[model samples]
Target chain A: MLFDFEIQGGDFATAGNASSQIKKILKQLNVDHRDIKRIVVALYEAEVNVVAHAFGGKISAEINTTEVRIRLVDEGPGIPDIELAMQQGYSTASPEVREMGFGAGMGLPNMKKNTDEMHITSVVDEGTTVELIFFLNQTPPNH
Target chain B: MIVKEIVEKLNLTVHSGEAGLSREITGGYTSDLLSDVMGNCDAGKIWITLQTHKNVMAIASLKDIAAVILIKDLKPETDMAAQSETEEIPVLGTSLPAFELTGQLYELLK
Candidate 1:
């Protein structure tokens, strides 16, 4: 099955709606609980990143019996240094975002931690796209 | 702590899901950011926040939070209450500020 959501920036009221719908779909499909949790976490983190940094974005999820693929694409000031942004504790979220309890710099790292394979592509002035794959057939390696 | 005790001590209104007032909450987390709440909060804790949005219920459900307390008398829209009911998570409202509620809950837990 496939699902798509248009994430609206600056709309704190509806930020996590997409992730919530994705979780419900995974549950109805009888996806493994552990796999679903991981996917949900990664998807939510990506969604928050889009809301915090991007102008707005789109989240798409493709689910099969064996794996789930999630894509987060945002149009905004792209990451100048993907490596630096991926580091835990590195954040550029504004004070307003931080006031709402985000911007701790854990979103990207947590996304990487929860997924089996992750890829990020960005152009400084254009935008960023993040792709994450979580395999249902394999156990999450010991952290 | 039982949800009833929290309601009594905090002087909160049962906005919805009164059936869950007897539910047990082992701990409490107070944060307005849904991300931090999702990352650090364990299941079955009472989530205290100033946010009054429908998505808050989604995070609580995802994290397995027992109940949600909206501090400072913040009120969620009707749709948000409906979502909480559907998720089986009780939504409570309180006139106490977030900091005061946090301290009060800490004392109760202690």
Candidate 2:
């Protein structure tokens, strides 16, 4: 199955809709509970990242018998240093965002921790694109 | 244990999602960081936080959390209350701080 969702920037009210929908679909497909949790966690983080930082974004998810692949592309002030951004305590969110209990600098790290394979690419002035792949057959680490 | 028991014991005000007061509670997670709760909270747990936004409800529904307790007498946003009603995950409130409520809850569950 293939799913596509649009993410509106700074729209906290509607954020996580895509993740919720994807989770429901995964459950309907009878995906493992553990796997569903991992995927939803990663997707929710990515979705919130767009809502927090980007102008807008799109999420593309492909699910098959073997794996689930999700790509999030956001047109925003792209990450200048992917390595720095990946650090657990690095965040550029505004104070208002932090007050809402987001922007803890844990979003990207949590995304990486939940997904089996993760890739990120960005341009200075354009946007960032993140690809996450999870193999359905393998047991997650420390499971 | 179920959510209603905690609400009664802790003196938590049920602001919305009364339909979900009967939901089961397995554990509790105390965190204001949305990502932290998202990353660590397990299914059937009660989330303790000060965040009162609609996104909180979104996270609760996605994680299959039993209920949410807003600390420090905070209340949920309008959209949050609406979503709580729709999802049937109770949005509870407490006058006590997170530390105190969590401690009492720990005793009750443990």
Q: In candidate 1 chain A, what residue range of length 10 has the lowest lDDT sum?
A: A134-143
lDDT of 2 by residue, B1-110 (tens): 99999999898899999999999999999998999999999999999998889989999999999999999999999999999999999999999999999999999999
Q: Which pairs of residues collide in candidate 2?
A: none
The first chain of model 2 has a TM-score of 0.96
Residue A94 C-alpha lDDT in model 1? 96
Candidate 1 ranges beyond 4 A from true positions: A140-143, B9-11, B15-26, B50-55, B71-88, B93-110
For residues B1-110, write the lDDT of model 1, one tens digit per residue. 78898889877898876767788899999987676777777778999998776767778877778899988888877877887888778899888898988998899987
| lDDT of model 2 at position A123 | 95
lDDT of 2 by residue, A1-143 (tens): 89999999999989999999999899899988889999999999999999999999999999998899999999999999999999998999999999999999999999999999999999977999999999995885677
Report per-candidate DockQ. 0.45, 0.94
Candidate 2, backbone clash total: 0
lDDT of each: 0.85, 0.94
* Distance from true location, Cα of B51 in model 1, Å: 4.2
